[model samples]
Target: MKIFIKTFIFLIIIIPLRAYPQACCTGGAPLSSSLGVISYTGENLVIDFSYDFNTMKDLYAGNSQLNDKQRERSTNSTILRFTYALNNKWAITTVLPYVWQEQTVRSNVGKTVQSSSGIGDIVLLGQYAILQNKKNLVLLAMGPKFPTGSTSKTDNEFGLLLPPDLQPGTGSWDGIGAVSYSRFGIFRPTLSLYTLFSYRYSFQVGRYDGQQEYRFGNEMVINIGLTDSFLLKKWILNPSLQFKYRNTQKDENNGSSFPNTGGSWMYLVPSLDIELSPKIYLHSNFEIPIHTDVVGTQLVTSFKGNIGINYTLNFKKNKAYKIKD
Candidate 1:
C-alpha cells in the first residue's frame, strides 16, 4: 500500500514538472469542476448533469478596472459527468460538455456578434484514493483532454472564422492533475471542510483547419470550502461557501506569447445542495468575482452559476461511508 501511494504521487508530480507551458485565460473550460472524492468503497456509479452560465462584461487591465463595457461575452454550457468507483482505491471520472458561446462588440459602427454552438472538449480522469475513512478522504486524479469539440464555427455577421476563445473547442490536447483533501464532521456532526488544487497544461498544436497553431494558456485552480447541513420540514439542505483562486499563463500563438489573454482571479462561490432521496440529489452554485488582474487589457467574467442533479447507483451497496453526491 505504501509503495502504491508513493508511485501515484510520483506520477502526478512528474507530469507537471516535466514541462512548464504558459497558458491563456480566456478559453473557459469546466474541467476542474468534475473532480471530487466519489466514494470510500467500490462498485458505485454516480451520474451528474448540469447547466452552467457565465457572463463577462467587465474589462480590466492588470488589476485596474476600465470603464469600457464595449464587449459582452457569455457561454452557456451543458455538462454531463460520470464517476464510477472500481474499488476502495481506484475510480474513473468523465466529463462531456456542450457549449454555446457568443461575443458582441459595440462601437459607432453598430454591434457585431460572433457566436457558435456545438460540442466541446471531453475529459477523462483516473482517480486514486490516498486515504479513505469515515470522516477523512484524500484523492489524486490525472487525465487527458480529448479535442472532440467543433472548431469550425464562424462569425455571425461576417463570413470569417471566429477566434479561438469564441469557438466551442480548443484544437489542442491538454493534461490536468488534481489533489484534494476532505474532512467531514469537523466541528459538528454535519460540518465538513475541503480543499482542492489542480493544474492544467496545454500542448502547442495545429488547429483542425491546419491554418494556425495555437495553445491556450495553462491554468491553475485552488478551492477551499466548508459545508454544513440543516434540516427543514424533513428535508436535508447542505449549504456551502467556497473561495476559488485561479491563475493562467499567457497564451502561445504561433510560438509567441499572446498579449491580453491570461491572468489571476479570485471568486466567492455560495452553493446549496438538496438531498431529494437516498439515491437522488440536487445542487446549485453562484460565483461572483472578488478580484481580477489580467496580463493586459482583457474582458473578464463578472458572474457565473450552475445547477445540477446527481443520481447514484451502487453495485455493492455495502460501503462504510457514503459516496459524495
Candidate 2:
C-alpha cells in the first residue's frame, strides 16, 4: 500500500546522531547532532524538531578522571531542522536552534550561578546523493554556518559579558562537511548499518565590540551504528545502537592555544523510534560517555538525552529522475 512504501522510506532515517556536538563544558548548540541522518531518496519535505538536555559534572585531566564536583553545567537546546528534497539527487537543509545554559560553581563560602539563554547559530547545507537505491545510499553534504544569533547574552548575576563558551552564539562563521554510507537488507529486510564522517572548521572572530578575538576548536566526528526494526501488526519499533568518536582541536585566543577547550571523546548511544503513522514518527536517545581524554582539567558530559518528532510531507515524484541501480 501507499503507507507501506512511505514506511519503508522512513526507515532510512533511523540514524542516531553523533548526538552532542558542543561539549558540556562548552555551552553552545549541538549543531551536528542531526546533520547526517536525513534521507534524500524520497521526494518530500521533512521537518524534525528535537529537544536536547545535557549535564556535566565529571572532570577529566589528560586521560585521568578527577574527583572534582565543585563545578556543574547544563544546556537545554531546542532544535528545528527542515530538509526539502530538490530532486532525486540533490536537496537543501537548514537547522535552527534556541539554547539555554546554566553554570554553577560551589565553594565552602557559597555557590555562584550564571545562566544565559537565547537563539543560537544557524546552518544551511546542500546535499547530493552520489548513489541511491532501495538497498544502499551514499550522500555528501557541505555548508556554512551563519552568525545569526546574538553573541551579546550577558551573565545574569553581574550583567557582565559571559565567556565565549557560555554565549548563545560564537560570533564566527564556520564551515561543515559530511559524508555518509548506508546499506540495508543484510539477510533481514528490517536490518541496516550506517557510517558517517563529518568535520567542522572554525574561523576566528572579534568579540566584545572587536576588542578581543577568539575561535572555537575545529571538530571532527565519526559514527557507526546498527538499527533493526520489528513489525507488530499496525505499529513498528526501531532500536539502534551507535558508537561515536569525536576529536576537537585546541581553541585559539588572539593567536595562541587556549587551555581546557578541546579534547577527545567517545560515546555509546542507544536510541528508539516509534512509527506513529505514515507521516509521523517519534525519536529518542540517550548518550553515555565511555571514554574521555582532555587537555588540562575540564568538566565533561556525564550523560545526555534527547527526544524529537519527525514529519514528512510527500509530494508527487518524477520517476524519470530516480536512476535505477
**Per-residue lDDT of 244 in model 2:** 85
RMSD of each: 12.6, 13.1
* Residue range 1-325, candidate 1, lDDT tens digits: 9867644554453333113211222444566565544654758888989998888888777888879766777888888989888888988988888888776666543555557888888888898889877788888889988888767777553345666776677866889898888898988988998888899898876764676788888889999998888987867898999999999888888889876778898999899989877678898988899998888677777888889998889788656343232
Q: What overall lDDT, based on C-alpha atoms, would model 1 receive against the true structure?
A: 0.75
Off by over 4 Å in 2: 1-27, 317-325
Residue range 115-170, candidate 2, lDDT tens digits: 78988888899988888887888888899988877778875544667678888788
What TM-score does model 2 achieve against the real structure?
0.88
Please report, in order, the local distance difference test score of every candidate based on alpha carbons: 0.75, 0.76
Q: Looking at candidate 2, what is the lDDT of residue 303?
A: 87
Segments in model 1 whose C-alpha atoms lie over 4 Å from true places: 1-28, 208-211, 319-325
| Per-candidate count of clashing residue pairs (backbone under 3 Å) | 4, 0
Error of 2 at 144 (Å): 0.7
